[model samples]
Target chain A: MNQDWTVIDGLQYSAWSREIFEQMHEGGLTCVHVTIAYHENTRETLTRIGEWNQRFESMPELIRPVYEPSDIALAKAEGRIGIIFGAQNCSPIEDEIRLVEVMRRLGLMIMQLTYNNQSLLACGCYEDEDSGLTRFGKQVIKEMNRVGMVIDMSHSAERSTLEAIDYSERPVIVSHANPSHFHPALRNKSNKVIDAIAANEGILGFSLYPFHLKNGPKCTLDDFCDMVVWTAERMGIDRIGLGSDLCQSQPTTVLEWMRNGRWSKTMDYGEGSSSNSGWPDSLSWFGDNRDFPGIADALSKRGFSDGELSQIMGGNWVSLLNRAATPASPFLQHP
Target chain B: MNQDWTVIDGLQYSAWSREIFEQMHEGGLTCVHVTIAYHENTRETLTRIGEWNQRFESMPELIRPVYEPSDIALAKAEGRIGIIFGAQNCSPIEDEIRLVEVMRRLGLMIMQLTYNNQSLLACGCYEDEDSGLTRFGKQVIKEMNRVGMVIDMSHSAERSTLEAIDYSERPVIVSHANPSHFHPALRNKSNKVIDAIAANEGILGFSLYPFHLKNGPKCTLDDFCDMVVWTAERMGIDRIGLGSDLCQSQPTTVLEWMRNGRWSKTMDYGEGSSSNSGWPDSLSWFGDNRDFPGIADALSKRGFSDGELSQIMGGNWVSLLNRAATPASPFLQHP
Candidate 1:
């Protein structure tokens, strides 16, 4: 195995234009999870999946949608970069119960239940309360399981998230979350949830979302390295991986949407008027100073062995996804 | 009191479109939730919202977004219909926690945490085991609380939803759900969840999701009314309301999304996915068809008073939203 692994970003919202893809390639991003919608650009908010797909047909090699659980592996085996067209928001599925099948066919593997506020499935960490999953949400979970979609509760509400962890037949993933146990906030997972997911055969993607870091924008590779180390001790190397919510190309209407609960129609911000939500100042730039590329260097600097670093980068996510795809997943229960 | 009470559908995503909305207006639908995302037509969604708002904006006397919790009252007082913009999916919020407040400020209220699958905050009910809420999901809830956004856990995972109910400082809402006791499925709420939400001063908007009903398309308003009655008896009048996901203008695409886990990457239909997730096959339409609108007439016909009708129609949701909007709600334990 190559000591210098070609890493896959667990989650990202950077523009998928050819130029940006090129930048990602330059940055050694072998795979990337592209976010499709938030509240700002919901399925009803936009009108062009067909158009988007047609565009993808133009660049089959550079970027395309992944449907099969094996597609990621196929891409890797073929020595090509992989792209997972994921929805940061569930708005695209709209009200259809069966759309999960269509999405899985379309190659959407990881999914976050609630972006910021409440949805049909569950509450957002940004929701007024951490009420667990809703009645309809439970049905949704079953469907995802039936289709082998990895359940991601990264941006979900605490109540709903813990509920999801317990509810999933397989171990659930946090795809992109920090540990509040490390950096206290609504965006990070608790130590209890982290360990619980691990015990259940789920994976946790350590995110470089600066907001959850103990040191905000001023944070350095050292701080990031420390996070990986902290998580390693808690969740072990096998259940950890990379999930970078890299929102490169700011000033794109997306940020405004993101700033305004683009993920859901819920945020903790008051209901008065439009204003900037407080974020960690001096954070790493997605295309420029990502600070941690796939977390390989950071983990190594933190003294992780090559074996551990491999798992933190992508192996863990792949293993979890593959397990979820297995036929026996249906019988999985909390261990 | 004009016994011909004006009515508005809370949340629905049927084969909606220009023709459907017209049917709704002709059918005495003062206003409808008009799901924008379920159909995969965001542009058309805005077109519908704009058209509806334009048609009724000036007729603010006839149609308007239920801005304030009391806006429903205002709509009722003015002999107008009310439209509440709620997302079956929090896809719009994307990943920004602050956007929840932004969406609320934009007059978007009643956001769900996830759509049919897992999202950032919590897991959907369709999930296999049902982990509650994620840590980030917890933050999303707190933010939604500070901003006075109502938590709707209709589609959330059971554990996450319960956690949200327990964590919320404000009353939450299961905008549309059936009781599992009446019919077991991820679409229906359990006795424990139903009772807990109410005990916390929340409300359950009994849905006419059609799929959630005990009967199929052959069911009538009487069956719908019975579900409402069942809900009232089990939960209490104060916590009951009309969430009748009375979708009309929704398109087949919307239906398709509902059929599959549209927003979710896979079909997360939970236990019901294989056996239909336990949602009742028989669907009842709104109005006298399902004997839904006739609920009041039937109740009155059955010797129930007007007070109860008022409570079921809009009073319950109104009160719950009001409590949620309260800066110092008596129900809140955290704040």
Candidate 2:
């Protein structure tokens, strides 16, 4: 593996600390999109952003905010990891379409239309029926496009994902999910959804989370690389990248909060059943930010050319951000 | 006196009930701009709006929501009182400019830039050093203009009110503040603020709260009418109307919440001193919504023409709403 190669993780919601920042540097990560909100409303999201602001202030040598696609290159040049803010649910906007521009201006570059239940915008994957894009959902997609905020559908239901691809003028990304062909997890995407994303010039970020991988925590690095190669064949190499969905250093309680937010009073196991209602054991091959080079080595050993390996690792994500994150309207530019 | 006068109160924060709704009808009020939020954040403001939704559902015969200026006329024609929502503080939006449009779309017709203290947007009257408009306040002024939410500067500091009037494209309003020329209360507007509002084609909704009136609760009806006549002389008659600032049937605790909403540890007297901390005694001439007719009668007895009396009663407010509440952008119109 090349030492100077740029690596990017599409999603992470870690119990972040200086140790994690050092590990990201050790892994040769140029950029990482981090979840700042799960089910937070607008003010709570602002507080989360304030926390990130403090993090950037305290660790200027380790990480900086990624306000645009160019910021990733800047971070790479500065030898620091660029942090892109994203929300895993529409709760941050709180049923307001106009908040899309506001959040984008505040440096929130990506937002999911739903989590794992019926949201005001769309139905989530765990719901009984998929209602597709709602009235406000369609409006918000338009606003997000105008404001240069990428629409993410990682936790959305199948119909909503397809409808989002159809409705969005800009590319829509599933920031963290694997192909259901690899592992039939509820959070994984179907071939139809993956194909639609590819058709719309969107990217599918392959997740390394144990629950979404074949054989769970016991899945081999070779099997993961093989799945990636298969996905690249179906949807062009430019349409696939690493997401990882690494929830590093997070306790089981964080997993429970992610699954149950404020919507459920009783316990909701989500991907885990009653017997398995906690964070899964970390994969031995790819555990934390320090393990990216191992995955790169595995992909290279599987006969992927250096260029193909670079695209899979980070170049495709940079390209996706450039293609989708530029503001469509000059009015959206801050004065 | 005509039986079908189109009466309007610029501001009220009553313990709203079906009985109060009936009193509005009995007073021949076509519309009232009611305070829906004071120091409430976005979620709490939404709950307040939801409560109003329930009220509308329960009392369809007595009151209805006024979405546009035309709705006031409709209410008058249908013999129902129209409710126009306003927020006395910037807390409802909570540092997000996009919420100005969202709150407007959710039937919030007006918003004060601040409420008796320095806010994220601007400085309130009670703040010793008025910083005027902050960076967020300038952006919010533009957003409020685009969305047609009337910028109310009644409780804002002098410089902030002047700056808001200058900045807003549409007519600004002091929805509930007496001129300091009448009585020098901390919440009252100065002549410069009043004149700026009038110069910008705005209207000043003269407050009838006892603390804002000369001689407090002992202020005579003739004296109140004389102040109105004097103010109409300083600013044009077209730029003056009644705001009442009536807070009927509310407990003293509600006043405390308004004065020090989670912002202070100790009690803040606001307009009231420590001795008279509770709500000032209701004025004899204007006790509740039912006393609006008495005010009109007093103005009529002061030798004002019937046309001028009609304008002061409600016609000016309807005109002001039509001038300021129409969305500047066609995109802001709901589909």
Candidate 3:
């Protein structure tokens, strides 16, 4: 693995501690997008940001906040990991579109419109009817574009995500979802979704979550790398990167909360028929933050050139964020 | 008309003026539920309340705020109209269920879970699919019950309304919708909804909005009184009252805001095929605040006894509010 590569994981919601921060540093992760809100409102989200401020004050050696694209380089230069904030659901804005800028100013770089349930903004993957981007959803997308917040369609329904890709002025991203062509999971995106993202010059970060893999926890490194190569050949290597939907050291209750916020009382076993309510086991090749090197090694053995492998590892996401995280007042053109 | 009766209109969104207050006083209205929010959020709703505070300060002789059922009597004694604030949608509370108690404390006596669109709480009448009360909706209903904030299902879908009526420990109210059996408007309730309210010892407020009437603006007062008599026969007279969804002296754009808000860019000419996106003509006889006497006179001509007419006019709503507006800490069971 090249130590100088800007290895940025597009999404992660691991239970954070000094140990995980140390692991991120050891894995040569220059930046990581972390989930801040699952089902929290504006005030509650503000409190969470306040807690992050305290953490930043306390953990200067291992981590720092990433509000701008340049912050990743700053973190790398300082020998620390840049922790970028993102939201798994749009509940934080709580029906007000104006809060899109507020969240952006508060260090949110990415936001998913829905998380496995229908939100005011967009239909979730689990909703029976995908009415596409709602009236409010359109308005929010416009505001999110104006604020330069990356729209993540990882958990949105097919119609909603497709419509959002068409409706948004900026390029959208499937921030942390696998291709349905490989796994056919409920949360996975179909080839049509990938084609639309590729057409729109958007990025797709492949998920390392076990349920998204073809063989779940027992998925081999070779098979995983092969899938990546297949996706790259189909969608272009410039549009692919690692999201690694890792959930290290978190309890089962967090998974329950992630799948079933206050929006559902009954446990919604989101994907298949097994009814396993807890988090699925991590894949053997990528169990923790420290396992990125193993994936890089596997990709190298799969005959990807050093430059193409670098793009897949992190350079592609860095390029996407360089265009996304800037203020929308004077936005740069797509590469 | 009997002057001794406590006449309370279940719903109104009048363009507030001293002249309307004078008409309310002249019509012998003791209290009127004035809509303070349609799509406004918590902060905007608080500003509206603050504006009402100023109105109360400046027009003490004309109108006073009604925080409880007893305030109706106080306004009657003072020869002023009692103005009770209510929200037409749950947008004011947003996603935080705890705001239920806060709104109640701020003199919001009634709140509709949905206003012609799907909300975080429940499905509105306009949504294609009605999944019933959401998980958050159920929790908010419980909090509303505990705080004695009346749940108004006027704009909710059938399944959501029925579920709310069944789930609520406190009696729910269809605060401003007519029976769909009489007029099959999208906003009207069916016999099943009316029966549920009647069975729960709740109240049904027959709307006087032209769109809700049998023949729009041309509906005869005799026909209106006949519908009332028919509804009273099905859901006992004790469970029925006048809501009269009046939009007196409001401009056409105000109606646009009420129906569309920031939710839609295109004008949603709701409930009809006609492109007349404005306030429809008020019914022939009942046009404004001064027309309550005409309704009473017409009902009298239709052979309503004095006690029954009085109940239809306002007594039933007063009784309903007496149970609804009090804090649940010391609630009295209904007969």
Candidate 4:
């Protein structure tokens, strides 16, 4: 990996601690979009934000909050990692549509309309049918655009993902998902969905989550880099970045909550068989915050130029964020 | 009108006051299912219940809490109207399935799965397509059945309603909706839905809301009684009772909240024209809680025998409540 290049993981929900924050700084990660909510409601989300606030106060030299795209550059200059808050589900806003602005004001920069089940906003990937964006969902997308929150469709259904890209005035993103053509996990995006996002000038963050990789935990870096190159050919190198959907050091119960939440009384072994409900073993080459170099080295061996590698490393994500994290977009202002 | 009839209104969400409580006693309404939530989350719902607790304490002579079906008889014996708390939407439980039992413990006896939009439990009548019960919805139905909380599908879509009836081990209730065959309103049920509820031995509350009547606000007592006769032909007299979704003395903004509820920034002229967005004029035959005698007289004049008229007025509801309001059912015990 080129040490001069800026790196941003589009999404991560690692078990944050002083050690992890130190590792993030050591790995030269300039920015990371950290998930703050999966199934949390507004009050629970507020509590989580309060916890993050304490972390920021205690470790100012290691991490700082990123409210705007320029803050990522500031973090890189100051030798600290920028922490951008996002939600994997819109449950943080509950049923109130106006809370989109409220969430944005609280620095929630990206929000997925649904997680692993049907939400009031849009259909999730696990739903039996993809009814696409709902009336409430359309309004939410507009408000999110107005308030500069990126519309993330990583866990949304295919029809909903396509519909969101069509409905959103600004570019929508798959903050942490891989191509279904590479690995047919339910969470992976179909080619149609990927093409829609890419054509709309959105970003695709190639996931390193085992289930989303071509051969689960045993996937080789060669296969992974090949998949990325194939995707980049269709989606453009300037649109691809690393998301690494890493869930390091989390308990099996956390996975259960991620899949089931309070929505189900019975177990929902999402993306895994019933007997293999725990988290999959990590790929040998990439396991934690300090593995960006392994991916960069592999991409270089695939005959990518340094400029192209820089674009995939973090330059593309920073450019997309610059365009997306504006409080008032021309499309929304003039539409 | 039979004064001795044990009248139990299946649902009502009026602006409660001393005046309304006085009218309930004046009209000999032995029990009433008062809606406690439209879009309130659990904590908000708890606050509403706390307010009701204060009302019960302050107005002990006029009203009493009814946690069990036998409490209705107890209230009648004490000459006070029994107040049975119900939720117009399942928002009170939010996304937590175990909160079903928590709500039941809080004396929430009846709960509609959806109000006027898609909820986690089921789709509302206003949605474009009814995809029926979700994965969470099936578990919610089972939990509601286990805890003896009556599943009310008054504002739910047809397919979702029918699926709830099919999925529930206990009989479900259409707590406040009429037959579409009578009025052709979108919120009203079709013959298929009515028959399903009837076949399952569930209760159907004939709504006195203007839009549900055959001719809106101008509907005559004769027209209303005739519609009742028509509905009784399909669903036996034993299954029908009054559920006047009366919003007496409430301001237009309250109606707006009921319809929109922060779900949309735009106005939703639910079941009425844009010009008639406010509360409709009360039916001439049934203006307030003191007008139960007028409906009973109209039913008598429509040629129902005294025994049949007694069953229509409230006897059927009380009997249904007796069967429906237990802590646990045998089906759940065995299942």
| Model 2 interface DockQ | 0.04
Please compute the TM-score of chain B alone for each predicted structure, in the order given: 0.79, 0.98, 0.96, 0.96
Give the candidate number with the greatest DockQ: 2
> Mind sharing the TM-score for model 4?
0.51
Clashes of each: 179, 0, 0, 0
Q: In candidate 4 chain A, where is summed lDDT lowest over 10 consecutive residues?
A: A326-335
Whole-model alpha-carbon lDDT for candidate 3: 0.84
Worst 10 residues of 3 chain A by lDDT: A326-335
Q: Report the lDDT tens digits of candidate 3 across residue range A234-268.
A: 99999999998888899978877787677676767
* Per-residue lDDT of candidate 2, residues B1-335 (tens digit): 46666789999999999999989877878899999999888877766876775576567788888877778887888777899989999898886666676567567889998998999999999989987899999999998887788999988999888888888889999998888888988888888888898899999998888999899999888888888998899889999999999999999989999999999999999999899899999888888888888888888988889899899998899999999987876434321
* lDDT (Cα, tens digit) per residue for candidate 4, span A6-65: 899999998899888888877778899999999999767766776676576568878888
Pick the winner on lDDT between candidates 1 and 2: 2
Please give, for residues A1-335, the per-residue lDDT of candidate 1 as tens digits.
24256466788776557667656656665567667666633343222333344344455555544445566765666544677666665665666555554445335566778787787788887667777888878887876786677778888877888888888787688878888877887778888889888888887776766666666666676777777787788878788887877666555344556656544366434211246454334455433423445446656766888877777777777777777743333221100
lDDT of 1 by residue, B1-335 (tens): 22455454556655533445445445444445445443223333334444444444234333556655666666556555566667666665666664554445334567778765777788887667767788878887887786677788988877878899998888888888888876776668898999888888898877766567665456576666677677777778788876776654434444445657344566544334455554434443453223345455665565446787767765556667677753332221111
Indicate the residue-level lDDT of B116 in model 4: 73
Q: How accurate locally is residue A194 in candidate 4, as Cα lDDT from 0 to 100? A: 90
Give the range of the ten consecutive residues with the poorest summed lDDT in model 1 chain B: B326-335
Better of 1 and 4 by TM-score: 4
lDDT of 3 at B253: 79
Q: Rate the local accuracy (lDDT) of all candidates.
A: 0.63, 0.86, 0.84, 0.84
Off by more than 4 A, model 1: A1-6, A40-48, A51-55, A259-294, A325-335, B1-335
